[model samples]
Target chain A: MINNFHSLLTIMMTDPTNLLSLGWVDSFIIIVYFIFVLGIGYYLLRFTKTGEDFFMAGRKMTAWIAGLSFVAANLGSLELMGWAASAYQYGILATHWYWIGAIPAMLFLGIIMMPFYYISKTHSVPGYLKLRFGEGSSMLSAVSFGFMTVFMSGINMYSMAIVMKVVLGWDIHFSIWVSSITVMVYVVLGGLLSAIFNEVLQFMLIWLGALIIPIIGLIETGGWDGMVERISQNFPAGDYTHLWSTMGSFQDNPMGIHWTGIVFGLGLIISFAYWTTDFLVVQRVLSAKDLRSAKMAPIIGAGFKMMVPFIVILPGLLGLAVILPPLVGENQVSAMNPHSYNEVLPLMLARYAGPGLLGLGVTALIAGFMSGMAGNVSAFATVWTYDIYKPTHLKLSKKEESDAYYVKIGRWCTVLGVFVSIGTAYLVQQFASIMDYVQALFSFFVAPLFGTVILGMLWKRATAAGGFWGLFAGIGSSIGMWAWVKIYPGALKYIALSEHAKDMAENMYRALWSWLICVIVTVVVSYLTRPKADSELVGLVRGCTDIPSEGDLPLIKRPIFWASIVFAIFIVLNIIFW
Target chain B: MIENKGISIWFFIGSLLLIYGVAITIANVYEMISPSMEKQIVLRELNFGVWWGILLVIVGLIYFINFRPWKKGNNNKN
Candidate 1:
């Protein structure tokens, strides 16, 4: 593992020139970005007089900003490196999430889940759960989610720290500490508002700077047509030539079936969690000007998701055309070494993006890392505030002093979350592939609750017993499968899956199935056992709304009506064209 | 609490559909334009027209597949 890490370190820093050239202008842009983020966050801080203001942007985030922020938040440290690697490695197939995962999930969330979420407007998912399962359940959830925040923050730190080390020619530990502290300052000073504002800045930087990278990669191959031609020679199989199949090399086998599972399964489960549940994302919507605005956040984010192929994915594929030649010889070989996979992007940026563009890309890369780290810190703060702090103080008054104290606590939570995560980053398995691993880990917490929260809102009979059982069952099933994969050879070897596929399924499907089990248990157990009385239920029923409701107008009548039609059109199109 | 006076439901739906359509389209288009692997056939198992046709049919059928309408005035007034 140490040797593996060393090789990765080697590949990550293959280009000394890109490292050397990064200087004052790049530093200036990063500092400017820091100030810009801080300016907006602190400026926005004036509007935050109470806990709600600090936590949810006073629940008045505009639709476009909210939408863009969701994308920004979703686009974490991994894309700063991973997507670029994926592009060079897998071709268009590297980005299947935009279709099978993202598109469906967004529509599902907006149409199916968001309306309900907006109606049952709470500060956090656990707060939503608290309405359903009572206090104890919320606490358990807080613990699990808190774990996720730490784990995810660690991952963000780990990946960005690697990039920092690679690009800045610094030591890895130094890189990790520096990256963590840099992200911590602004996020700690502010909160989600700071995270959200920086996301907007970071995303635009990612776009204008990162998008041009593929062009340079393509240029090295002579142009798009030439790049396509070279890949065609290597990958001549059916659907292989098609737009989505991927321009992969058989000799190299960049990603196999497991890789496919990684793309698709995560889309179904963990990716859904990213889009729907995470506070960093949902909070973006939570801060919306209205429910209408909130609904649009993911939709707008999908726009960026769809376009990312040009910036992040294509470069990875183009790297097959450009960089892979030097590493693997003309015949291409297994991308077993994680660093080799990781280097796919950095090498392209070094070789192709010259001088001014290089500076911009470096700035954007830092901005992207900042956006990711900021989201993690702010999200960690959120869980700390709502679940751990505010709920325990029964006598906590709504006075100005009390509210300010809550906001202060929230900010400090951000600081603690960042520092702790930086320390933990060294241990995370997904250090090499941050987004996929971190998000899948998040699903372990988020999925079990999806069943619990939705049921609590709809089923008044959903007993605390059922909630506990459901949460327990979901976590148990997921963890059992995870352990089985790791310990039981018969389970894993006979499973005949790639490490990537198993990991992806462990993250996505295991949690989804667990959630399904928990949902069934919640309903059946609630029905079988004595139900909560009408008086005991804390939410609106029948025509009466306001069970943590956001008060946004419905996005469309019979939303599934359009959603199904959309699904049908694509299905038929795929059948006919192939 | 703000009043629910100004709203555009189709805009949201349209935006999501456009996002879905465009992103998936690129994946398909990129698949079409690029190669699969060295040892495999070059034609896509899932093509643009087929994918679109099936999608259109599903969208068409979704209008009819019949789901319970989320009732109006379902406010959260606890």
Candidate 2:
């Protein structure tokens, strides 16, 4: 019976094509992580009695907790693996995603935008839209956000399974079922509180597990200077080590992007859009205990976000420098050189980590994926319950539901959302390219929504008609541009405005165009329509709102002070790398 | 974070790290003693498992003691 059980367990868990196998020590650590997260959810269940507690964590998180959770929610395995792969493919140009592409926008959200969001007491980003714009704009935002969140969640699920299959030889079905069920249980039981707690845990686990890669790699390659020398020696055709020196011309860099595209398109539009408007990340800040904590959270997040490249990008650089036989792209992968660029982080992990550390690394990846899915599902539940279901239900029935009733709906939505995501995951598994389109679909909404939200907050003269039409026009134009490129292969030069621009450059330029169209349409429409009264716009718009001072204790205590420090560091890092 | 009144997150992290650290350390030491059972890993000569495990144990102990539930008035609820 014991031998039969052992064989059954092995058959259920392991895949035949796996490149690495975990020892018992590694397996034990993974088991502990699952139990730890589930235990947190189960333990927190009693505290999650009300809708606010379930959906917003009762707004009692400190800056550190909320900050770490905010960063961790975006620090998914997909983000890690994908960016690491990009580092190997495009070199240190990929660091722009973490640095210029992220830090400035994150600081902007904390210092400039958090006041509007916090003072408004909105539950989600669309909730803010309803107050500033109207029901129509809010509904549009909520529906698109809801749909995209679940779709992305499913993609994360599918990606996790694939990673597990490739790295650990786990069966895809087993990986999917186990991880999905685990996420569903915790999320349903405790909701956002559960998600936030797990996110914080995931953040720590990620650092502990993955930080070793860069440390070991640096030791192996002599150090940063040594790694740079080795990488430069290997790829002398293009400057791969310098961040900004080669960005003057598209042909000088591996990414085929101009500095303007990096600065204006990504650094300005895309980064601000995703960081400020996306409810998935903003919801973490909204869980802060007070206005000050809310204001401080993203700044703290920005500081840590700067350091992530060491673990993520450095390993990829090390791979380019030292890994033998070379990692190839998916199309070029074969039985002999089976690893693809997507497998860079895992390949590095397999190279350095032994039994005990191997478990930690795998656990970190699992934690990252599960937390990412949880973030998506929890955001979906909030939007569905608060934005879509509640408003629609009340408008039709003309009755206000109790908070408990909505909390119950939120719980049910969590379950339903998980099931939908699982179904979507299976669907994506059948047609892998669906994942790319799903990610593109996310970009379509975010850039446009940023225009709507920023205009709504900064310009009091912006009317409801303007907000709605601007969002509609922005999304429509983004989709149109995407389809244009799809239909006409030559349209890329027209859209990105340079023949040298690659797919990544095209995405940035497209976001910039969609945002401009949104702003222009909004400006024209707002001038044509009557505006909201200043009294009505008090907490929603910048000029009309009375901003509260966070109170001066010391320069060191202020969010702005830390933000300035982070900004200074940002500029210095850019200059040093330049 | 208020829900953490039952148990602090730090304490939980500490407990898990301590457990893992000790396990890894013991596993590494046993392999060192028995030489034949050790798996070939990169930088194995560095004895990373021993030192890293010890570091984890020390950090974990600090967190575990500081936030342990049984300690007097140890609830670090935000």
Candidate 3:
């Protein structure tokens, strides 16, 4: 057993440099994957004839397709690389973002929010906001979302380029251009359907590509207990293994976030904003054929989401346990720099996967990057065409244009969006860490958007003026807090309760404060402003809307039944990990 | 037209194998081309990509032939 373990360790610790080089088979596999993606887009182009087809997949998607796309769209290189890096840096505590931060919000979206969104038959989140709170709130959200989507697309582009350059010595510009052009082609041709199809395909690839590393590592370590023991031996950070143990206070955790900050700031504010309101994710559910499928989509996504941390996070722990120590030992820490912890996933892929598998793994990373970019650009195209162009450009014309005309505009927006994303990718070069920058962006836009959305949906009294100002207040507060943290540098420690928690606290606490400010401002302004009549708000607000009755399905087939089972499993996992 | 009953199970299975095959081929080829002292011990032991790729291709082809959507029927919507 001892001899076998040592041999396994020796095999796992093969020189990292050799792992970076790709062979012919790997290149062929990658080429094939790209061809498959492009082919699917071309094939789907015939189906996307009208603007509705372009933006919403003709509202014909089933529960599984929409559900897979919903989860896959979010499971980009950003999530994989960013969370893996976070897992390396913050340990199992990073799992909070996946479980508490995502699952609950996703479940809430399916159960509580899908009814309003589906019943309204709006084209986008901004369109729904327009129906609920009028043009003022809608325009604010549409413009903000437009910019956010393009920026996020660029981040994915930049991340993909960096991985390609680091792993295969590919030029960063070459990588970015190849991916951008490929994503632009399919998205422009087939629109949201193409993106959704590719997202589903990429979802499968990501799982298959990523599954091997953890399986190999666990076998070597003997299992979960063995991995925990080996990790402790190598790193001696007991807190890293336990999820909730280190989360007692800001000072106690490697993440430097207290339970209050984790539970409220991220779990409540950031997660809810991203899961329930983000157009990129919500648009998938909105594409479902019926209300039941729309609601079931997110419930299915939540179940899949619960299993994701094991795939993305475990590799980071494996890197910390097996890969980093040898590099650190050799005084070659520069090779595996702690600051560029995002390299952890790529590094593990190189070490574990041989040629053919290696190609698939790399293709998986590329697919993730493309799927993320495609999702963002498609969502951007929908908002830009419907909200921005239709209102500003089409409104000026005396005659109403055909659906084909709008489809043309959507295609143009896809082209424009991709170019803008390429430009934004260059901007991402300035950021030290992709995840931190992404989280900060989310706090700035999503947190505030959530504030208005929540108020508009739940409180019929939320006037257009109140929704607009509340959203504005939330965004302003988030930016102000970000700037304050930058200038003072020491302020986060004071606000967050521990000196160690300062960096992460800046984002979490900013989200919390921004949400508070938005809610407060909205409530105050709502009272001052005259709200729309109940007639105008029919089917828009919770009280005014009729709940779609669930047909008498069997317990096993019911969404609520599956959601409860997921929640129970989530509780058990947390307790065990705690 | 493909029914909204979701993607066929056989098609999904075929795709998964093809992906696995391609991935394995890439790994094996990389090992063969980039031979080193450390790699020789591991790479020489496992040259599974080509055979695996061939096997997966055959299985995938069989599935595709049996479950091709075009053969089932077509819808005028396209």
Please tell me which predicted candidate would have the highest TM-score against the true structure: 2
- Per model, the share of native interface contacts recovered reads 0.00, 0.44, 0.32
Q: Work out the TM-score per prediction.
A: 0.73, 0.97, 0.89
With candidate 3 superimposed using the best TM-score fit, by how many Å does residue A563's alpha carbon deviate from the native? Answer: 1.0
Tell me the spans in candidate 1 whose CA falls farther than 4 Å from its real position.
A1-20, A216-225, A234-264, A324-339, A395-401, A426-443, A457-461, A493-502, A505-507, A533-578, B1-78
lDDT, model 2, position B21: 88
List where candidate 3 sits over 4 angstroms from the true fold. A1-19, A324-332, A335-340, A428-442, A493-499, B1-16, B19-66, B70-78
Docking level for model 3: acceptable
> Tens digits of per-residue lDDT for model 2 on A1-578?
43443354356565666656676677777888888889988988998889999999888888998999999999875777888899999888899999999999999999999999999999999999999999999999999999989988888888888877777767788888888899889988888988998898888888888887898889888998998888878776756778898888888788889999999999999999999999999999999998889989999999999999988898889989887677888999998877788889888887888657888888888888988888998999999999999989998999998999999999999998988988989999999899989989988999999999999999999999999999999999999999999998789998998877898999999999999999999999999999989999999999998888767557888999999999999999998888
Instruction: For candidate 2, list the clashing residue pairs, or say none.
Output: A15-A169
Model 1 docking category:
incorrect
Give the alpha carbon lDDT tens digit for every residue of A336-387 in model 1: 4223656666666666443234445666776777777777677778877878
lDDT of 2 by residue, B1-78 (tens): 474476777788888889888877877776667654444767877777677778778988998898888887777554
Predicted model with the maximum DockQ: 2
DockQ of each: 0.02, 0.59, 0.28
lDDT of 1 by residue, B1-78 (tens): 112221222222222223333333444455456743421311234352225423523442342222212324312100
Name the weakest run of 10 consecutive residues (lDDT summed) in model 1 chain A.
Answer: A238-247
lDDT value for candidate 2?
0.88
Q: Any runs in candidate 2 off by more than 4 Å, and if so which? A: A1-17, A335-338, B36-38
